[model samples]
Target: MQQSLSRGSSPLALLMRGVSRLNLYLAGFSAFVLLAATAAVFCEILSRLFFGKSLVWVVELSGYSLLYMTFLGAPYLLEKNRHVAIDIVTEHLPPRLQMPLAFLVALFGAAICLYAAWYGLAVTLDQFQYGSRETTVLAPRSYLLTWVFPLGMVLLSIQFVAQAVACLKR
Candidate 1:
């Protein structure tokens, strides 16, 4: 009975816990990025209105911050089952079929995320190897910003695997 009760407490649960923590951190960081972007935009607006000038980096940085925030928060959103989904059909399905369907969906999502992560890493590496830089006032290395894509996708893929396993265990 104890073993059966503990069946759900597998190594996957441990991995999920770690991944959950990481996602939480990423989500918090994303929130900070969002706040910073808001501040930058506000500052730029004020500067332009009052001083007839604006920081060139503000617009570029705000765009990058928005991108970073979306990517970083995505894994956490997936883990929390907060992403947008049209589940009218699934919700009406019988309980017997629901788990399997959910598992399959998660598996498909994981596969897509894994592919994206691979592609993003390849692109970032190519940029880094070729010494690519953004054509902006800040002019940061493009690869440095691009690295967030693979990192976020990897996290999202892990969360999807966790979701699939949870569905199976159901």
Candidate 2:
């Protein structure tokens, strides 16, 4: 399990633990979302070819599913060290040099993701206040989708922070 710097008897630790669990659960849901989206796309193609008609909703729904899947899985992936990496320089670096570099990079990632989370929260709030709706045919409230951006960003930022903490603990 991913753990916060504060292990026990602290509210922050509790919150972090909850966030870790949330990442896991959401990641699982993300997998389901991907499967459903794929099935929807396949059905749409079949409908177009066989019935000579299109499933208009599939395109928009699939787009949303893609967005959700990307965001939802990110935190868990980062926490588990399964996220993408380009280690050309790092792999070649001496072991002593790599630790500080990795920690710094993790800190940088945390800072950037945190800033994005803050901006995403602002946009989400604006959408909520203005009652914005997507201009798409579905006309769903913009918040329905906008909320996920901040949620994902927040989760990712926390995961990055956790990674940095782990690096330091090493």
Q: Which candidate achieves the best lDDT against the true structure?
A: 2
Q: Which ten residues in a row have the lowest lDDT in candidate 1?
A: 1-10
Question: What pairs collide in candidate 1?
Answer: none
Residue-pair clashes per candidate, as listed?
A: 0, 0
lDDT of 2 by residue, 1-170 (tens): 35545489688788787887898999999999999999999999999999999999999999999889999998889878899999999989999999899889988998888898899899889999999999998999998897888888888888777777788888
TM-score of 2: 0.91
Measured by TM-score, the strongest candidate is 2
Cα lDDT of model 1 by residue, 50-157, tens digit: 999978899899889987998999998987779898899999999999889989998999899999999999999999999999998889999989999999999988
| Candidate 1 Cα outliers beyond 4 Å, as residue runs | 1-11
